[model samples]
Target: MTATDDAAAPPLDVLIAGGGYVGLSLALALKRGAPSLDVAVVDPAPAGAAARDGRASAIASAAREMLTALGVWSTLEPLAQPVEDMIVTDSRTRDPVRPVFLTFAREEGSAAPFAHMVPNGALVAALSDAADRAGVTRIAGSGVTDFETGTAFQRITLADGTTRRARLLVAADGAKSRLRALAGIQTVGWGYGQSGIVVTVKHERPHHGRAEEHFLPAGPFAILPLPDNRSSLVWTESTETADRLVAADPFTFAIELERRFGHHLGAITAEGTPRAYPLGLMIARRFVAPRFALCGDSAHAIHPVAGQGLNLGFKDAAALAESVVEAARLGSDPGSADALSRYERWRRFDTVQMGMVTDGLNRLFSNDSPALRIVRDVGLGLVDRLPGLKRRFIGAAADADPSAPRLLRGEAI
Candidate 1:
């Protein structure tokens, strides 16, 4: 239905220009935290489209808590696969045997596994359902084509010729966000000349919730466990090599996959079409513009080596929602410069920090320099033996930032 369906339709409090995880979560978070606020999500995809996404993500502990706070985790728990342990190794694809240089197992008193391997589809489905139940509007099969900023509200023109006026507009449209560009926000980043080949594989033996990250010379090759003896693979390689691998015949691809996967999982076969995505780091210079704000990949897109991309997006959702809801409750304009500045300040530093970490990691590990390899291996070995350091690292991965928004810390805004 159009926003003008009712004679007394109120202006939207927030208009999200994307319906992915970040956008959907933001809508739900706002609706739950400030029940009186009107929120709507605009996207070209129909509802449930995310459920068909074959890729899976490693949801960090803090992000999991945010989901739980939003009431989306219960629906996802049954389909989720906890990562009971993690093994990191540095080796060549042709090495006789990969030796683990670093290991992280669930400590007796640890809050939970560092993260959980969840299907992107399942996570999106849960978020969408929760948003619907929370009274957030989903304008599917259309996207925000253009928006005009005004003193009081931003008038958004959708692809379907409908107009929505909101106090604030958020661009969660992704790394190549059209809204970001329209707002004249430029990003600084470069391609790694690498592409990640993603696919799912069914193994003959159970993985037992073990996740492995093998730091091959090309890049990290991750095997994240899934339910039903299946695992998600993120295989990184040079762009040329990735193209060849993905285009190879099934038998040829399987042979190459088996070489890197090893025999520990017994026999394994591809479960779906293998896809390749280019690797890069893109950080928008500014996260906010007047009544507009950027979220998710629109704000910062980092390498997948640490698997924190999704988590960072979730953090943005939580932070922005809190900032807006708090402003509204205080009888202030949610889209005012002050509220938008708060969100930018809260998320920009953390996003930049994570971007640097992932970029440095990709450069350090995605290479064949013998000296560098030795230094990294030694470093990993040292961290492995240092209990205090290991725990601290795991805590950082699982815990929210010290200045994290309330929702991210499992508290209401």
Candidate 2:
């Protein structure tokens, strides 16, 4: 209930190294699922820092279910925008007409949309509030500087010169996770030579809940609908070009944006400062070692071609929470080899599968070869024409495997 400061604080059942969406969600789920477990989150950011995140993410249906189960969705629902339909197109930057090759629409009988676009700040705030309410300790302005495992627990040294112990040390840190590296977990990945320019735009007309992905020669440029008349752009380009565009004057940047964003939205204006993040594909060689485990981007970082990165992280939290809570309920070591092994087995394949799918998609479409373009366009057209196949694709995007955690199924753990 308070910021942890005592160096001799009793060992926590779970100590998360990052206080982002994944870490906070996992902590909230564990505390709510099993109140007796001692959980604490140590983040390097100062207190109340999550409210400043200027990005938004697509929360898939399964992730929404998990959030709702954790009692955080209600606080975020009013600010979220449900994606009603999506269209994919392949074309060059100056193409007058970008023909839609694939389309996915929300089914009539579905109770919820396939996904919703939520502001990163709002999601984090909601999760943090829920975490606090559930009695999870919040340690801000600090991070795990080093850690070592004993037979029963791990001793963690903090950047603030505090020492704490935990049965499980979860690395929900980002792609360049120091905890992951400190744990001796090697990653297999390479840079994409591209970067995604992320910014929010205010348009003259409403998007009507439609999302668009334009497959340009460099990469996929996504326009995701946000609440009101705003849309979030994940515009991809060569790393060099991306950096230049972000650094350009507003007038010049707007000119380039209008080239990619057509008259369909009438007129558009960038709402805030644009930032570019380099694209890459990274997956830890292993998800667990001794008392440590990886979660979220620490375990896998994929290209944003499919917009499944956040959902994958949410799934990781759900599966890990399920495994740990079940182990705790049985009076077994939640961080025992058996428990960690089960969590790894449940998530590693799914993480690898998503990584490869996004990687292949980026390779197949992020190019200018005429033959490859024709082949990919024809493939997209063929898939679009098959109603049953399209339905399955949509279902797969919204639903999870039958073996998913109870929280992901909108059930109590």
Candidate 3:
């Protein structure tokens, strides 16, 4: 049926653009968190099967907590490899600081794993399942084309020409969010001088459930353990260098990687084609405008050095949903400017703080200055020895109580 036809249409309280991790997951969170609300997510069309050859994401502990709160942690648990510890070292240094270890099991003194390293496909699939269980209408192969505001609601037109009048129009459409543009939200961001190349590698030795970060002069090269003995690689470098390497022969690339990544994995062979993603930080000058709000990659895209980008997005989703739920209980329009502004206030400070931290770390560690080399190494060592200091950093990174949603708190949001 055409959009204007006098046909049955889904009544939605929230119309979200983009069906990627952020959009779909938040849909489930809202549906599960506020069962009475109508949450619908509109994507391009038909769910595409997970792509194994392309991209992958490192799911942190905090991210796992959110997913668990949504009630699908056990299903996802099988596909992930537990992160038992982490090793940080200088790319050119001969001996690393005996590897600083931090694991959920180690820190919490329980059988639970610290974090799970799952593929992007697995993560997306899990969110899709959650959406299904929550009865979120999946409007695939469609997107917001335009919208008109009527003081109380936003009349949205999708690419399929469907009309959706929603209390809130959320932009989870990714780094380049069309919905955000339509809402007139502005962003302040700049690109790093680097590009990140992500790939999977089969190492000769097992990764031992360990995540490793090599702080090289160009950027950070991360080797994260995955299910089985294989490891996921995130190698960052100058844009030009990254481009050349991604286009280089596999053997040539493997040799260069071994030199920088270290052969500790023993006779490592690279697999999968490399994808070079330009690094940057994009923070919306404002997270909400009028009847629309931003979440996930739509609102802020930051450097992945800390592997906190997705975690941050999940945090946004949980917080936004919680605010809306409470507002509804209090007999207020959850999508009002006032309601959304609260979300912006809660998230903006944290987002900006993390962006600055990651940017500064990228700049400070991605160099070979003599003074910096000594100072930074000492900084790394100092954190390693002080168990109290190490625990705080680990807890913070693991998503322990930092303006998170109840779902992020390992609770039902």
**Candidate number of the best TM-score:** 2
* Candidate 3: pairs in clash: 44-141, 44-142, 45-140, 45-141, 104-114
TM-scores for candidates 1 onward, in order: 0.97, 0.98, 0.93
After superposition, the stretches of candidate 3 with alpha carbons farther than 4 Å from their true spots are: 1-11, 49-54, 93-105
**How well is each residue in 1-413 modelled by candidate 3, as lDDT tens digits?**
01232114544578788877888788898888778887778887466643232456667677888888888778888888888878787645445533443222357565655667877877888888878788887777777898887787788887776678888888888889887788788899899889999888887888779888878788888888887689888899999999999999878887787777776677877776888999998999889888789999999999889989888888888888888877876778868777798899989999999999999999898888989978888888888788888888877777777557687877875
Candidate 2 lands at a TM-score of: 0.98
Of candidates 3 and 2, the better by lDDT: 2
Instruction: Report the Cα lDDT for candidate 3.
Output: 0.80
Backbone clash tally for model 3? Answer: 5
> Over all chains combined, what TM-score does candidate 1 have?
0.97
TM-score of decoy 3? 0.93
- lDDT, candidate 2, 1-413, per-residue tens: 77655647678899999999999999999998999999999999998797679899999998999999999999999999999999999999989999999999988888788999999999999999999999999989898899989998999999988799899999998999999999999999999999999999999999999999999998999999998899999999999999999999999999999999898988899998999999999999999999899999999999998899999999999999999999999999889998899999999998999899999999999999999999999999998999998888887778666688888899988
Across 1-413, the per-residue lDDT of candidate 1 in tens digits comes to 22443213567888898889999999999999899998888888876787789899998888988999999898888888999999999999889989899998898987678789888988888888888899988788888898888888888888877787888999999898999999999899999999999999999999999999999999999999999999999999999999999999999999999989999999999998999999999999999998999999999889999989999999999999999999999989889899999999999998999999999999999999999999999999999999999988787777646678888788888
Model 2 misplaced stretches (Cα beyond 4 Å): 5-7
**Which run of 10 residues does model 1 get worst, by summed lDDT?**
1-10
lDDT of each: 0.90, 0.93, 0.80
True-structure RMSD, every candidate: 1.5, 0.9, 2.8
**What stretches of model 1 exceed 4 Å from their correct place?**
1-9
lDDT of 1: 0.90
